[model samples]
Target: MRARLLDATLELLVERGFAGTSTTLVSERAGVSRGAQLHHFPTKNALVVAAVEHLTERRGAELSAAFEELGAEPVATAADRRTRLRAVVEMLGDHFASPVFTAALELWVAARTDEALLAAVAPLEQRVGRETHRLTVAALGADESRPGVRELVQATLDLVRGLALASTITDDSARRRRILREWADVLDRELGKELTA
Candidate 1:
């Protein structure tokens, strides 16, 4: 029941943004009664904030699962390393372009003007950002203790996020693919230099 409400809230958030989504709408979408929805989440802010947190956890798990499925074979050659790195970059880009990101963006936009929502969202965003950075480092098999590697990983995340934002305005698929590919090459070279130095 709670899961259903949260899922519906996420769908509505992506479809209608925070201002348009209401508890009534969420109840109807979830096929759960208003009473039940209220019983679980007493306010719209509670419902939406919980939904974001739930979606973030789910998305993070999905990313970890996807990364695991990418195979753990040793990179025996430079070509193999490049291929693996490119796959990671592509995966990260796809993640940022997903509906979860769209839904989160809606909350972020709304939170900018709503002090209460901002209070709720700020810590959540920090936690999500840190988790994402950690996951990216793990996915890339990066040692952040090395100089410049941490900043490079952060830049990769920022790049993907910016690409995701651009995609919200229009079909940025072709350009995104090109940019990700170029960025992947840059990562490979930079990380390779760090590894060998």
Candidate 2:
């Protein structure tokens, strides 16, 4: 029942943004009764926030699973490291371009003017951002302690996020792929240099 409501909320958020999403609509979409919806989430803020958090958790788990599938074998050569790096970049790009990102973007836009939503979203964004950084670093086997390595990792995230944002307006898949491919090459060289140095 809770899952249904949260799923409906995420769909509505992506399709209609925060303003178009309401508790009543969510109940109807979820095929849940008004009383039941209210029982679980008393307010629109509560519902939307919970839905976003649920989606983020689910997406994070999926990404983590995908990362695990990349294998635990130690990188034996620079070419091997580059291959893993490219795979991680592609994964991050796909993640940022997913429905979860679109739904979260809607909340971020709405939260800018809505103080109550901002209060809830600000902390949530912080946690999500931190976790994403951590995951990306781990996925790439990046050592942040090296000079400029941390900033490079952060820049990779920012780049993918910008690509994702550009995709919101139209089909930017071709261009996004090109950019990611090029950026992955740059990261391979730069990170390789840093590691060897």
Candidate 3:
């Protein structure tokens, strides 16, 4: 029943914005009796909190798995850089259609007014950043824990965020591709000497 309510809330959260998603709707969509939902969540806020946790757990695993898979690929040496680079770029690029990011945007908006949701998401965000740092270091074979990698990682992340926000309203994949191409340029410039020809 708890699982049903959370799954329903996630679906509604994607369709309706945070304020628009309601406990009643969740129960209806879940086909869980109202009594069962109330027994689990007790309030709309509690249900939303569960939704936040649901997204956080799912997305954290998704990202970690993606990066882990990227690292796990065969890249015997620096001569293999282009292959590894393209694979990493494509992996990050796949986030453009990611339902997880869409759900996260909804969770981000809900967190603005919901302290519990914010609290639940904050640590997850930190863990994600750290995990990203580790993956960058592994991919670049540099101490990306240092300041230089911070700039590169944060810049790339910000570009992705800007594009993700735009992606919600702007239904143009060409525009999205253009935005990422520009980002690839920035990365190229920043990594010029280090790209190892």
lDDT by residue (1-197, candidate 2, tens digit) is 99999999999988888899999999999999999999999999899779868877876787777677776668889989888888889888988998889988998998899898788788878888898899888888888989888998999999989999998899898898889989999999988887788
> Which residue runs of candidate 1 sit more than 4 Å off their true CA positions?
none
Worst 10 residues of 1 by lDDT: 58-67
Best-to-worst ranking by lDDT: 1, 2, 3
Superposition error at 52 for model 2 (Å): 2.9
Q: What is the per-residue lDDT of model 1 for residues 1-197, given as tens digits with 9 covering 90 to 100?
A: 99999999999988888889999999999999999999999999899779868977877787788788887777777888899899999998988898889988998998999898888788888988898899788878788999899999999999999999998888898899999999999999998886678
All candidates: CA RMSD in angstroms?
Answer: 1.3, 1.4, 2.8
Rank all candidate structures by their TM-score, best first, as comma-separated numbers.
Answer: 1, 2, 3
Give the candidate number with the greatest lDDT: 1
State how far residue 88 of model 2 sits from its true place (Å).
0.7
C-alpha TM-score for every candidate = 0.94, 0.94, 0.82
Q: Candidate 1 overall Cα lDDT vs. reference?
A: 0.89
User: Total clashing residue pairs per candidate?
Assistant: 0, 0, 0
TM-score, predicted candidate 2 vs. hidden true structure:
0.94
